[model samples]
Target: MKTVICLVHGAGHQPLHYKYLIDALRRHGLTVAAPPLPTSGYDDASATKTHLEDVARVREYLVPFLEQGYEAILVGHSYGGRIITQAAAGLTGEERAAAGQDGGVVALVYIAAFTEKEQPLTPEILGVPPEDVNPATKLLWPEAAIRAMYHDIEPGRANEAVALLQRQSPRDLDGAAVCKSSDVPVPKRYVACRQDRVISFGTQLQFAEAAVAKVVAELESGHSPWLRDDGIRAIVDCVLEFSRRRQDDV
Candidate 1:
């Protein structure tokens, strides 16, 4: 069976963000799954709790598929990357040990995603000082920033992307602060976007280093690499190649 590639979307964004990447992976004869995450008002404590709950829920749904003889690799973008880390932490060592065979999630891929040890993703990227930053904050994408970040995307596509932005609860940011995972011995990769405004490239690199990812690639594009064919291809190819190498070693 082909290893399953489970794509987790970032905070406030839906699975639709990964449509192009998913299609490309499928074209290469890889199995892909992108699941939508729950969205609620920013700064709502209850909503934030629900968001984390939803992350676990999605993992439960995928677990059975894995048990049914399918190997899977968890791929996460932005906030979704944080969620996958939490979900993977929830699994027992035995479960992860079992999945290690066949290159199924023998590694994790984070696309401009946050790691527990990285700088906080805040709305202050607009240039406000940290002291002025609020725990319950929301950042709206400015038109100019959007253009710079997603230059490869079509105008219409970029406009549509705006609709996917959600106001994340303050708790979501808080959750990431205390998140921790035992080193499950799975290889990890971090795809950094050098021009990202939402999450600083420096922060992403720092997170990758803290997480101890085996491989790290920096893209010249913005936060959303899916809009660029080359970026998407690089990610999919990396995951596939990593999976193959793991299987061979086993």
Candidate 2:
């Protein structure tokens, strides 16, 4: 069966934002499953659903693939890292196979994303200094963050990216995700965005270290690494490399 990449989107942004990456992966003969988080709706002033809700949303997409005997690769971008970590909790090949189940999550890929830690991951935690940050933290489109988040992308794509930016909840960032890094004992890799403003290079290293991540791939893009010309392919290539190791180990 083909490897299916289950994409967990970032906060505020919907799955559609992953269209470019998804299409590229598909063209390479890979399957992609990108879902919009429940918290991604616009004008959702009262969106109180936590990261667990987002986890459940991802599981909904993965379970179907597992049922059909296909390996699912959980790939999270930015805040999607929190959701994928929680969603993948207790769901691994060894555990599932031991329980007489099959086709579990094989690996994790974090693209400029968060990792398991005691405290909830916030912008401050990821190296965005709190000096001039917002209290509500509800960032509007085309904000200064874009300058840092997508600095490397072509200037023409700015408006398109701005249009996709939505209001992410501070509660979600401040609240701890449901799962721990140790909870999901699977081979993983961290695709660090070298020039990421949202999560600095040093901060990304910190998260990877905390998770004890097996591999790390550095990209020369901004916070949103997928915008780089070779961004999505590099990620898929890294996953394939991990997959090879997984097969060899077994």
Candidate 3:
């Protein structure tokens, strides 16, 4: 069997956000898993550490699956993207060398995912002033506004989504600083959102370039591409193609 696709969610969001994408991948005969992060009541620093820890936890859960002769493709969105990148970097050189043959992660698909060094999670990356980078600085999202962030979600479902929103820590904002540098040799694909208000299109392009992936697809949706049909199709198609390519290489 091919490796399953591990989906990672962004900060202030949960795995539930990727429901549409997960279902679509499943329909295409792919296994998917999306784990939640530890951002509830965390400060920026603590949240950043927790993000790495979350990556470790996910890797641990995934190891047994890999050991069982299951390969995996990691897919991350926003903060989830950052977590997946760290996880990929954390893999030892020897471990990465054994991928695709037995049970190892074969590729990484970053849906608005973050890249190390090239686009560190600094205040500048977020397009915010140093003084405004504080988590306690009051970044409030009303229930309605939060729903608006997800375009296709119905009002009823949006309310439920808002309930899952957690207060992101400022440390998470600074956490990208401590990421150890590692070359991601696995194949990668970056899905860029053209009208993303949270992370700019330019930043996504820069990240895609840094990832050194062979393909990059742009969606004219907002930050949450999963909320759009065309965006979801783009992601599903990319994963399927990447998986087939990996399988063919084997």
Candidate 4:
């Protein structure tokens, strides 16, 4: 079966923000899906959406591909990590086969995302104050946002990426991980951004260890590593290597 890589974005972000990384993945002859979450967008709709809606949106988008026998590899970023974990429940390849489906999720890859290893996102965890949220849009890290999410990115490009930021529901930060990370039966890998200010490197390691990620890769970038060429290459290499390892295991 073919593999489909689904890249889930974090709060206040859309697929456009990951254009370089997505394009690179597709260039490798891989089918990639980068869906915008219901909890994020530039409208009032996003303010009302919650974690459950985010998970449902992803699963709903992938259902057609799964039924078509295309095995999926879910890659979550930041808040997306929790969504992937829950969205993958009972959707493993084996589980799908048992249910008479041709394909399903085969693995999980997290990039500076939340997991069962950590508590709900807090101001302290983000290295920001509670007041950092935008009053009008409810977006996180509104002030000095570049420092927290794109410090390692080049100035010109980082500004372009930040211009696409949208509103993120505050409810997501308080939502609990309904499913245990260990309970998700699949090959797991974690990509930790070494210079990430939004999610610190030390905290990323803790999440990876807690989830018992079989593989851990490091990139010399901040939270939004996909914004640059070298960072995108590093992430692409990590994912491709992990996919190969997964195939070998099977």
Candidate 5:
């Protein structure tokens, strides 16, 4: 079966945010799927999106490939890690039996992501300021508005990054991870960003400690490495490496 590569971005982001990375992957003759989270397009302040909705959306995209026995490599960044965990669960051995599904996910690559389960998102988990937390779900966190997401980027690009930012409901942001780390039955890899201020190295380490990643790779990049040249290479390299290793295993 041919392998499938899908990219899911973090909160306040759409598939376009991964445009550069996608272009690079395609340049390598790789087919990439960048799914738009339903909760995205925050232009409508009246709507709210949940993590589970994105999970279901991603699962839908992977199901056809899985039913055909195609190996899938899910590359998720930031909040996307939660969706990948839930989306890939159905293709795992246990879920296969329960759902009678034919597809399989070969690997999970988390890029400076958030990997929490069954709890509300918080600054404690994300290593951000506690004041950023909106207890009433009254305010939205604009990821692009913050310089830290792509602090290393060129000046005007920051505004362009903000242009890609989505205003997310606190309800959507607070959605809990549906699947536990133990529920995900596949090789998990973590890409640590040494200079990540959003998800600090210590917090990423805390996530790794709980779930035990099979491989831990590092890059001297900020939260959004896909935005940087080296960061894009690191991400593409990590996923391709994992895919190659999986093929070799077969």
Candidate 6:
């Protein structure tokens, strides 16, 4: 059975934003599952949803694939790290095998995402005042988003990405911190964005350290690393490397 990479988008982002990276992975003969979070919708109910709801949604989406005997690698970006961490619990290959299932989550990949097991992701954690960053009440300001998320991206593409930004739930940000990666029972990898203004390089290191991730990649890019060609290649390389490791183990 082919391994599937379930790519979870960050806060304020939809799966469409990951098209380039997803396409590149597919071109390499890899199966990819990029699902949009419910919190990324523009509806009022979406704005009110929490991170746990997003986790539930992702877990539900993976059921059919798992039932078909396909192993999965949960790949999270930005706030998605929290979602994957929670969703992968009790879904490990070993755990599923014990239950007479042949397929389950085998690994986790975080792309400049939040992984702190203790710190709840709130505006305060993001270093912004609550009044300035209310996702439930307003959408991301395009120019500011470009400056923080796409600084290293080309101007045109950055603008386009900003335009695709959706309203994310503020309540999701207040969701409780996830369990430690050690508790998840799967190998973990983290891709650190050095030039990231939102999630700084130092913070990425801290999160990786806290999670005790087995692999870490340092990239000189902004928050959205996939916006650049080299960044996309690097991510694909990382995913492929993980696949190779899984094969070797098998």
**Candidate 1, 77-164: lDDT as tens digits:** 8877776766665343345556663223456788988755234555555233454333344434445436544556677767777665
Window of ten residues with lowest summed lDDT in model 5: 136-145
Would you estimate the TM-scores of all the predictions?
A: 0.80, 0.88, 0.80, 0.92, 0.85, 0.92
Residue 51 accuracy (lDDT) in model 5: 72
Off by over 4 Å in 5: 93-102, 123-146, 173-177
lDDT of 4 at 2: 77
The residue-by-residue lDDT of candidate 6 on 140-230, one tens digit each, is 4666677678879988788888888888776775557445677888888999988887877888888887777754578988899888998
Candidate 6 Cα deviation (angstroms), residue 246: 1.9
Task: At residue 132, give the lDDT of candidate 3.
Answer: 42
Stronger candidate by TM-score (5 vs 6)? 6
Error of 4 at 95 (Å): 1.0
Candidate 3, residues 90-197: lDDT per residue as tens digits? 353237455533576667788876765235555565664455433462233554335335545556655666665666755554444335324655677788888775
Candidate 4 per-residue lDDT, tens place, 168-200, comes to: 886664455557788888888888888998888
Better of 1 and 4 by lDDT: 4
lDDT of each: 0.66, 0.74, 0.67, 0.81, 0.73, 0.81
Stretches of candidate 3 off by over 4 Å are 40-49, 90-101, 117-140, 143-148, 151-160, 173-182
What residue runs in model 1 are displaced by over 4 Å at the alpha carbon? 40-51, 90-104, 117-119, 125-152, 174-182
C-alpha lDDT of candidate 6 relative to the true structure: 0.81
Worst 10 residues of 2 by lDDT: 132-141
Query: Against the true structure, candidate 3 has what lDDT?
Result: 0.67
